[model samples]
Target: MATAIGMVELTSIARGIETCDYMVKAAQVDLLRSSTVCPGKYMIIVGGETGDVRAAMAEGIKRGGELVVDTLMLPNVHEQLIPAISMTNQVDVRGAVGVLEFYSIASAIIAADVAAKAANITLIEVRTGYAIGGKGFVTLTGDVGAVRAAVEAARKDAELLVETTVIPRPDKKLFDALL
Candidate 1:
């Protein structure tokens, strides 16, 4: 089966949870994540076959109504994306490091994908709307040139880029703290 990922971000936690329940019951999608984010927003992420994920997303959007903040359906997501977002991917932070912060989780995910495909960089982490007041951020590491290219690519079309920085040669302690 061709795997796909879908996400629904809602303004209200109660409505988001209710939509998530309807979404899952509407299709054979697997619920990957369902939780409240900072500032009292909620999100639901699901994964399954392409069609199933689409069906689930459709149900979520229909049920979300006025509470719908944002929605996404990636038919062909990067294989490493989930692990990176889940903070389970181990990446060696060598040479240089880049960070991209965004105002929305969907924008951050898009930036991460663009950055990963634009340069030979390893994703250190992809955090979304958990403890950062509903914002999102992604970290990457590679050679100086590669890191710069990745960060530049991510910044080009970000929804709201809070900040972006590329450290040419970060100290080990910084990597330890971040990674």
Candidate 2:
């Protein structure tokens, strides 16, 4: 299992692909994502051992250079984070719900990890890329206090225009739409 995750956002799609190649070749890291984002941006995500992830990120950054726009490296990631990012996490849809939105995918991912580690919450979803126009958001569910705390912690860790809301007990339709 990968114990660490790293992502690098780039302005040039061609350069992003090149960086992705260099990153994976530099270390034994899994390429989790390498695709274009909204507004003509590109992103690369990698996961592996902490040291391997660091080495891959270093190579990506070196190759990306000025094309690199944003980056994040979580050496000790929460267990639920990867599944949530992969859009495979099971959402029980119980308890209060919290939503955290950010201007960039990197920020959204970072916040999601922090939120999961902060409280006893289940990550419902982490939406990013084209459907959202490059902006990203995370949804989680837990008890009222846990949801609130998770939202706040995530909001603080994110950058750019961050917005957060906690629904005491969301309507079924609301959650249905969320899913």
lDDT, each prediction: 0.88, 0.88
Candidate 2: list runs displaced more than 4 Å: none
Poorly placed runs, candidate 1 (over 4 Å): none
lDDT of 2 by residue, 1-179 (tens): 44999999899999998999999999998887888998898989898899999999999999999999989898889988888887788887588999998888878888999999999999988787756789988999999999999998887746874688999989999987776
Q: What digit string (tens of lDDT, one per residue) describes model 1 on residues 1-179?
A: 67788899999999999999999999998888899999899999888899999999999999999899899887776666776776777785467989999888888888888898888888888888999999999988999999999999889988889999999999999988887
In terms of lDDT, model 1 sits at 0.88
Q: Given candidate 1, what's the lDDT at residue 13? A: 93
Q: TM-scores across all candidates?
A: 0.90, 0.90
Candidate 2 — which pairs collide?
none
